[model samples]
Target: MTTETAGGPTGPAARPAPHRVVIVGGGVTGLVAARQILRDRPETTVTVLEASERLGGQVLAIDVDGVAVDVGAEAIHLGAPAAADLARALGLDATVIAARRGQSVLLTRRGLRPLPAGVGPTGPTRVGPVLRSGILSWHAIVRAGLEPLTRRRQAADVAVGDFVQGRFGREVTDTFVDPLLGNLHSGDIHRLSLQATAKQLVPVAESGTSLLLRALRKPTPPPRRPDEPAPLPMFASWPGGLGALVDALASSLEGHATVRTAVRVEAIGRTGDTWRVDTGEGPVEADAVVVAVGPRPAAVLLGPHSPATARALEAVDTASVATVVLAYEREAAEQNPVLRDANGLLLNSSQSGVLKAMTNMSRKWPLGHPSWHIVRVSVGRAGSRVAVDLSDAQMIAAASGELATLIGLNATPVFATVVRWPDAMPQLTVGHPGRMAAARAELAGIPGLHLAGSAADGLGLTSTIASGVQVARTLVG
Candidate 1:
């Protein structure tokens, strides 16, 4: 174990020690950085300083009453190399569970209605099912069919909403794309960056190809082994929750991470070759420092060393959100396969109130003991009133009300927890990708410092892990 000196950094009266690393954050990025450093240079003393009393930062797990609630990053969007490799190396079992499937009940003007077959977040894949379904008017469907005839453009950047609207019309954007993709980003499609959001679809658009044809032509992989469960549509959890993953990474670092709970960083400055991280506790020295906090905090910490980076980061924007987990007996949730078997439902952004999405935990994982059904509800958006102004009680109430209305039940939740993330999910607005590339180039000259976390790339657990791994590789070398 890394021996952490809670006594603070070097003192003026004492002889300063050799070059040691002090990771500023204890989230997945910092933990992964510390782990990677140790693997490469086992002799270097490292310390991770965290302002929070607990680890995991946004990725947290809380026992609400008797059920565990994932306060942030409910699941991995895409299980890429970084997340998968780390889980295996840490001795954590990677079990796959199928994502939510089956009839999705939609709350519309006509009340709760089920989405017909062939239609998903992307779009309707089967013409027969879509034609037979009443989700869209014939006129709207005809407009959508004109996607193949839509004009293509080679612009550097365009709004996701504009692109989709230009091709499929407003009905598709508001009804299908907005609710599905918008809910995922906690953003509006009109303002989001196509390069950042629909990265894979860019080539198809450039080729003047058909979205339906591309969907149809996409290869489908074979089934998984009988012994190996199929991977979840998105990766998630730390086996014991995100906290466990943080703990595991922290354990490998020994004394490297200096967790300073409640000590807010005041500012950061450069002195000769060293970077001084000023905090309420004191100034900690580093060869170079990575401000892993969100844009606002990063701005506070960066000071004037890199004004452009700070400004860009500050302008990067973020959405505020809260996750509420409600538990119920198995019998109480009968008929809702999502609550009984699948991963849970991702609501369309068109839904009113503070709630946006929900996940069924017990249904998605292999539970050891039979227990009550666990469901997680995410609330608020980037600039929504629910994000900043609403109190925890208000947020919970709003979420619970929506739950009651949607599920046809209004009983008081046995366990409810609210998590307020001020700058939770970063909004990759139009030109965000270009801006990120520029920021990366500017920071490239700075040594022993690396920027990481969800804001730097995509969102979710897998991205976070990947960010950490990338930072690790940079710092280790």
Candidate 2:
């Protein structure tokens, strides 16, 4: 609408309305973004609209027999300090607890064995670990060791499988990289991007000579002295599961921002330099808007006005996944050595049939449960249809059957609960980094429009939180 002057209606005048931001999703990312925006621009108005009745998105928890069980992400990766910093700042540090043990075994043809010391999410880093574990045959080991002789890959972007297999052999890719990187993204390594997903290997990938040679030349740190403070744990979580984090983040925004649940944003369009956010209830006019939902939802909202932006978002791939939390009889669990200490098992490519990985929550957080031996089982992966048709009962049965075969736990679980997330796990395919960059570059042309979520740049709590902080700073600064 044009502003009316003394003589006649003037062309679209300056924005006289108070500066307000309409956040399109109420998940952790959106809420965190809202929190940061309010902190930076104290005078600006912020509105958080969530489609679901509950917040937290994938970071959720459910009650089973009166005990809160995390059906989604349970651990907070401490490699980055975004989550830890946010938790501490929100007074959630006291509730945080470190893993009692982190020793995880790999499912091999020989049986479950300790993972190679130097093996990571990308691929093998040291030969000694693979040699000791005997997970690789001598032929594959020699092939992997000779990777220094292979020519550097010429592609600007390559598949993670190709990069790892080129540096290591195919066997190593299947045995080592599959479970860590593949299962992590719920995607196939052959399709997942090396540059986008595996950042640690880029230096070695670009080196053109040898991953092992470079790994061997790395310096080792000296032992810590008694007076030195302890480094942060690799992973941590509150006793209340990740839901505590969601609760804390939501509470931090109380009175600082307007948070509304069950409010779905239908479309976003520009009206004379102002954003008109059409929602289920009514329209919300704001100075800026942040689309923090998954790419699918974001695509639906952005398609009407910004087709290019919407298509860029819609092109992103996602996989459906389900989590099954099973409680077993204490006596049966105590007898099983696998449940005694350490984390659960990571299924290699051969064993990636019905289960992805299982977490032994009883010992991972031993203090939380003394009576029940609880296990959290992850199912589904990109391009896999095994879990698509399974119901809650079927999922539980499959999870139990696998646990029995893997750990010799024949006893039935005392309780079980299933949580399914459809098209939730985002896949970073080859050229994904470039696609994201192009999408962002295109988004920059459109003022007051921003994208921030796991779907935006990365997955997991740390990356999502970092994206939120970045989008907020960019919007408010």
Candidate 3:
């Protein structure tokens, strides 16, 4: 239908109002989504609903005797594009701090041994360094040397521990990988999924390629500009700690978003073309909704409408772990030879128990005062409930005693604190990602409903934040 001149069309139709997107949960995933939605869909009205009073979730910080330290997540790979881009946009480029140079030692049957170069959580990238380090026996080293001839067992998915064991042997997996990766995920190595945990390795596992060779062909970072401060390390954290990242995200969301805290979302359902997010007070409606909470809470919300999704979420299990921080006099701690150049120390499960690893926080990061040396002692893992029942005082004492025994830290700590995370880490077991994908694909049939977070994408800051960013783009389209 052709219309006339300056008056425009004969009959004008009013355009619809801007879209409304409701984000559930207030953790890193939810917060990232909220900021992203506001950025991508500038006209869209955004509201973030948080179940708890805290908005950052695991990105938390606390002051221990005048020193600010992360009680939750501590650092991130600032060199990675996603983190770098986000930090640049947030005006945090100048404030990033690198992990100070040091070495990590492994507590093996032969006692404390320096971790060989080119070694990772799974296995050594080069056999030469490991052969000399003696973390494994002569016989085990010989077995690993035969990795090029190892039989290929291709599958769609496999356990990380099994993959390492097939290429190396049980001794390598138990002595090295189990202590490193196990503590990282707070789950068992044999149960963690290779596909979900490390997607890049899935292709290598399926191709039966030599992981050692592939690991060697690592990607190189772009050359740094001369004006840039120093080459940004692989990881960096703010002087305020990791919590600063969360605070910056929240700050950016101001004026563009309506963030509500301590407001519990009881359930979510579709009514007509909009979604109804029911809170204790009333219902908040929106055109689209993102469920970025953990698995258990997510299950509770999706149970009524999408039973399959609820079941899939319910099936995903989690393990509990704790972080205990202890501070000591700089002179006292540095007296021990290990504390001078130690970034951290890892102990096998079979070794003198309770504590599995310890991070020399003062040496690792320069945020604290030089007069005091701080250390973070990590305890608990999958299938072990030792940390679950221990009282805070008991945990502090036990960790302090372990430090004294391990490094000759005979002097009493100046200050100490313990923080417990109960069932906080999600277990991405074998076949879990496929199960989640199928559920999400099925959920696609329902309009205006989506999932994004550690529960859906697995743990780690990179994966969780990436999931939220993807969800934002989906909503915009």
For candidate 3, write residues 1-477 as lDDT tens digits: 223222111122122358888899888898888877766656678889997888888888788767788877887876556667667667677788888866677887787777888767676777677777767888887787677689485774688888888887889898878877777787888888888876767777788887655555666768978976554567778887888788888887876788999999999978899899999979999988899988898989886777778877898887777899988898988887667788888876667477888988888888567588888898887777867999999889998899788877768888888998877888888878778887788778887788898878878787777887888877766
Q: 1 or 2, which is superior by lDDT?
A: 2
The global C-alpha lDDT for each of the candidates, from Candidate 1 onward, is 0.66, 0.79, 0.79
Query: How many clashes in each candidate?
Result: 14, 0, 0
- Order of candidates by TM-score, top first? 3, 2, 1
TM-scores of all candidate predictions against the true structure: 0.82, 0.91, 0.91
lDDT of model 2, residue 211: 74
lDDT for position 274 in model 1 = 81
Cand. 3 Cα-lDDT: 0.79
Q: List the residue pairs that clash in candidate 2.
A: none
Model 1 earns a TM-score of: 0.82
Off by over 4 Å in 1: 1-19, 40-44, 94-104, 108-134, 205-209, 220-233, 255-263, 335-343, 366-371
